[model samples]
Target: MDMKKDYDLLRERAELLKVLGHPVRLCIVRGLLNEGEKNVGDMQECLEIPQSTVSQHLAILKSAGIIDNSRQKTENYYHISSPLAKELIEVLFK
Candidate 1:
């Protein structure tokens, strides 16, 4: 493989890992993998954390391309987007 391509891949992996390094973010990603897709309210209830806190983490994960979200009316539902995240969650949770 080309050096530039390898560097870009490594950078992306590092960025994803960095974003998931937080406990809240890890939990959110794991939850998303297991639950399919969920809105902030569902995550807040499951995590027992404030909605704002969950939303903040969700934003980071989404920005990293590790997660994706869709809007239904006013509710935003988030789910895992990266296969690496899903694989990691499976390994960690199982």
Candidate 2:
């Protein structure tokens, strides 16, 4: 086994876990998975958190490639983009 390759894979997985470890981020990810695609307004309302807070968590998830968004007119609808994240959320809720 190539130690460097293994280490790189571990690091990537660790980073994904770290990104999902936050309560707000976890909620956002889970919400996206369960509710399909949603915009900042929708998530803010569901989470009962400030729009800014939701956007901040979204930025983190987006940076980690855990979620991706599509633009429809004026709003951006976000959805889960990582299969690993989807499975993790399902296991967590189960």
Candidate 3:
């Protein structure tokens, strides 16, 4: 294994793990994987957290390229866009 050659990949994996390290964030991803796409309202309801808090976590997940959202009129529906994230969640649950 060449650390120098794979440094970028390692860094990206580290960042992903860091983003997922949060309990809320991990729960959010796991929910998406199990339930398919969801809006902020739906997530907030399920998480029992403030909508703002859910949005904040969503922003971090989005910025990290772990999730993506589609605007449907006024509501933005989010889904897991990263295959790595899905695999990680599956591994964790199993």
Which number leads on TM-score? 2
User: How high is each candidate's TM-score?
Assistant: 0.87, 0.96, 0.95
The order of the candidates by TM-score, greatest first, is 2, 3, 1
Regions more than 4 Å wrong, model 1: none
Give one digit per residue, the lDDT tens place, for model 1 in 1-94: 6999999999988887788889999988887887789999999999999999988988898888899988999998898889988897798889
Score residue 85 of candidate 3 by CA lDDT: 95
What local lDDT score does residue 26 receive in model 2, on the 0 to 100 scale?
97
- Scored against the true structure, residue 20 in model 1 reaches a CA lDDT of 88
The lDDT per prediction is 0.89, 0.96, 0.98
TM-score for predicted model 1 compared with the true structure: 0.87
User: Per-residue lDDT for 2-93 in model 3, tens only?
Assistant: 88869989899999999999999999999999999999999999999999999999999999999999999999999999999999999999
Query: For candidate 2, what is the TM-score?
Result: 0.96
Across 1-94, the per-residue lDDT of candidate 2 in tens digits comes to: 9999999999999999999999999999999988899999999999999999999999999999999999999999999999999999999999
